[model samples]
Target: MTALHELTAEAAIRAIEAGETSSLELVDAALERVTSDPWHAFLAVDEDGARERARAIDANGERPPLAGIPVAIKDALSTRDLTTTAGSRILEGFRPVYTATCVERLERAGGIIVGKTNMDEFAMGSSTENSAYGPTRNPWALDRVPGGSSGGAAACVAARQVPLSLGSDTGGSIRQPAALCGCVGIKPTYGAVSRSGLIAFASSLDQVGPLARTVRDAALTLQAIVGRDPLDTTSLEWREPIELPAGERLDGLRVGIISELNGEGIEASVRGAVDSAAATVESLGGAVEQVSLPSVEHSLSTYYLIAPAECSANLARFDGIRYGRAAEGADSLLEHYERTRDEGFGSEVKRRIMLGTFALASGYYDAYYLRAQKVRTLVVEDFARAFERVDVLMSPTSPTTAFPLGERTDDPLSMYLSDVCTIPMSLAGLPALSIPCGFADGLPIGLQLAGPAYSENRLLGVAHALEQALALDQAPPEPA
Candidate 1:
């Protein structure tokens, strides 16, 4: 018999509906594993609350799709009554009065919130090292990092502490970690999911997504949380609910390989895995061809400028005046602001904030920020043109497998390059997913699939077909 903690969310729901398992049993099993978490995947655990909710659901005999499923939520999302830190010291110990819309919807659908997972402070870094609390180690290799800023969410699923989790992707936070951790993660089209209660980090780029052990589990999680919310003005309105495709064959599908992503900089092993995935897609009766998105070359540079600029403006709210930690014994208001921020934010957060402030400064504004926006437009146009030629695009999620922790902490450029293949799709506000394709020296390599806006159903369906055909074993080795 399989451990209850290792069951996928979809399977757990089935067990509950069949009367073979109770909600309390699942929550208890998950909580036990969480308590013994050696990777530091969780920041806080809500044992009492989770127990109460489980007991109520078991008593009511109403099993929703995720009725008894236990899920780990990224700390970036606000949870009422639970501290929502965004993994920063400044907002430490602060609880939101209202839960984030995505989280609320998940609970309403009967998913149990097991606890909050750790992340990079304000979702800034590619590796989980930027987290103020501490770094989250990859379950496969304890010395290596679980990619971030959604490292905790990915780690929990890969470690089997829970089969489903929620993560936020802004320039590859969710997908990169999923690839490194050997799980499935999806970043939905921007505005397809509400961002009302999520702590802002590059507001235009941040979108809530799901990370799970399987493709079907990820799709079901997305179905439960995606919808328009009145609180978020950017949320998209849709009359029909999104549905996962029931079919597995890609008889007439067209797949595109971005030319710019294949050349130099990508590791040989990573490239080889992508080629294999493309071959699998072709074998599934789909047409595969090379396509160009020239402006994608400038994605890293443009993303650094635009994302930091927006992060600088959005993070200005945490000046100790509103909520969060305030400095004690400040002689004047100016001193108070300086001390509060200096103590609250981590080194990486401070660096980006300074870079953003400099970019948006009076004389440099037109030269840096405005120019980056123009290049962003070109990148978006590049994707639009490529999509006209092909139905979907595929690439390596990262240039390499998980690297040793602290390997690139001093080399910020190397860390930024980790997200190179992922940022272009984010800039275009498209739906993208990362699925385990193969392994390199015992580490998993991810194959990323991306499509035009609001094309999640087709994207996931194609990925599911590839997943079935490749039949790669994604289980991580026992934690060290």
Candidate 2:
């Protein structure tokens, strides 16, 4: 019998249903893995809660789709059992009274909440080094970084600490780290998954998605998470599930290769990996065409302005009184807020808060924030127009693979550029995914596939086809 730790969520459910494994055994295995290198991924481990949930499920013999399977919820999401720090000192002991809607959904699907994973402070940085708790080392190469702000979540899944994990991607948080760690990650359409309990970095851009080891696993997790939520007004209800045809040959699939994603600023090895994957798609009967998203040039600038503006607003609620750390010697409420926030927020978080505050300020709102919003519309329209020509869009998940920790941290501009390829889609609120394509310098690389809004099923299908052809048996980096 396969050990519970080695099984996928789908496989775990089947095994439990078939009486092949007990929920306790699976939960214990996950707990053991988490305990083995607690620093690498988790911020908190709800061992007692997890075991109790597992025992309850085992007794009922009611295995929801992922019954008894362990899942690592990104620290950005609130959980009553665990501290929901956004990887910052400001939220060190902050635990929400209510669980996130997605967390509730995972429970309904029979998933055991293993723990909360670390991240870049408030999901601001590209590397997990920004985490107030310290960087999450790549499971593959201990010296290198696990990409962020979903780095810990991806690391947990890739390292086999859990079969599946949740991440909130404002930029490439989910996909980039998954690629770096040789795991599968999907950023569902914006608003496809509720953001009710997620710590807001960029409210309009942030989205919750899954990271797993396989396309099927990612799809399974997506199915469990996707749905409308009354709590989140942004959430939408699709009439039906986005189910791509299984075993469907990629022959004749219309794939658009974004010309802009290639050349200039792309690493030769990364380019080669993308080319090889594209060729694999061609061999499998998929036609790759050179399509352009002209507005992509403005994506970064628009994102910088828009994201910070929202971040400033959403984060204002963290004024030290209701949550996290508090500053001393404040006679006034405003003074208390300033002192608490100043003390609680990390440098990166402060940087964003200031930039966002400035952008939304009365004098600059028209020039910066409003202009960015207009450009956002254009960015979205660009994809809408491109999707008219192709079923899916392709790009490299990042310009480069996982860099050494702190390689780009000092240079915030360069670090922000790491998410260049991803923010455009997020601005457009479209579904995109990053799958492990190949390796460069023994480090894993990822190829991105995006689709129209609410086209997660189609994107997953396309990703599945590519995964089949690539036959990438990407193993997680051994823990240091």
lDDT for each candidate structure: 0.91, 0.87
lDDT of 2 by residue, 133-195 (tens): 889988777888989889999888878889999998998899888888888899998889999
lDDT winner:
1
Give me the runs in candidate 1 sitting further than 4 Å from their true place.
none
Evaluate model 2: give its lDDT.
0.87
For candidate 1, the per-residue lDDT at 139 reads: 88
Clash pairs of candidate 1? none
> How well is each residue in 1-480 modelled by candidate 1, as lDDT tens digits?
567977888778888888889899999999998988898999999999999999999999876778878888999999998988999999999999999999998898899999999999999988899999999999889999999999999999999988899999999999999999989999999998999999998999999999998888999899988978999999887555666646668889999999899879999999999998998888889999999889999999999998999999999999998899999999999999999999999988998999999999999999999999999999999999988889999999999999999999998899999999999999989989999999988888999999999889888899889888888746677654
TM-score for all models, in order of appearance:
0.98, 0.97
